[model samples]
Target: MELAKIHRLDISKYNLTFLPRKEEMFAEMLEKVDADDAVLEALKSVFPLPERNTDVLLHGDYWPGNILWSDGKIVSIIDWEDAWIGDPLADLANGRLEILFQLGKDAMIYFTEQYKSVMTKVDYSNLPYWDLWAALRLSKFTEWELDENILKTMKERINWFISQAID
Candidate 1:
């Protein structure tokens, strides 16, 4: 479905900063991923981001778990607590990372292609940055879960996104 209308609420109301601000949490995540200073420095450079026009409502936590399907169709999107008006790519990036983690890179590619087919106004150049943002956002939670495999996968995904952002 296309987002044909914009929301009246602005992003600032959500207290949504693009990147994580908790130094301790970020440091812990970096240690878990074995991310070096260079990586952290690179991420820092992208912050204080230039203002972009908010064109649609973003499901701030868009992931497979939040989506319900029936008869091979999306029946409902259940979560709205984190919803806000912001860059639509943020939603795409969150969904993309979760799909990549659950499925694979190819599935993410397919999803991206399908999304782009309908969302013509998408600025692809900003996706990698958003992807990195999503990864970092997820890292906070993934580290706490006791599953070793999931933790490893999350680290790999975060590093991969970081590499993409740096490139």
Candidate 2:
């Protein structure tokens, strides 16, 4: 839904390195994934996003948990702590990854398709960039430790996004 239009804030403030601790955590994960300096540098290149006029009110954390369902239908969405005015792709990317991690790859595809049907202006080309950013943001979680399977999935997802960005 269209929300109040706000002034554009410097996107660098939302990058993985915005916080020292998050940057450290992301760097550690990159090492575990055997990511080279090039990959690290590429991830840092998400700033100065391609000029666009697609800003919207983003849920910011649009994972399944925040979506309330009634009788198998979404009735409402909760959680607004991360809500902000930013590229809509960020929310799409975050939701896609969450669906893939919580549901499955097939579910993610279906969810994406369903989303595309309603939101016609989605810029597919930049999605991978946002996906990589979302993965890096997820890597900052420390209080809630992820299991080996989840961690592996996250790494694979990150790699896939990186590959998409490269190509």
Model-by-model lDDT, in order?
A: 0.64, 0.63
lDDT of 1 by residue, 30-62 (tens): 446633555556556765344453545677777
For model 1, state the Cα shift of residue 148 in Å: 2.0
Q: Name the runs in model 2 displaced over 4 angstroms.
A: 1-40, 141-143
TM-score of each: 0.71, 0.68
Residue-wise C-alpha lDDT for candidate 2, range 9-128, written one tens digit per residue: 344455433222323433455556533455556666655567454555566788888877789777777887776655767777788778777887787788878776667655667777
**Which pairs clash in model 2?**
none
On TM-score, the leading prediction is 1
- Which candidate's lDDT is highest? 1
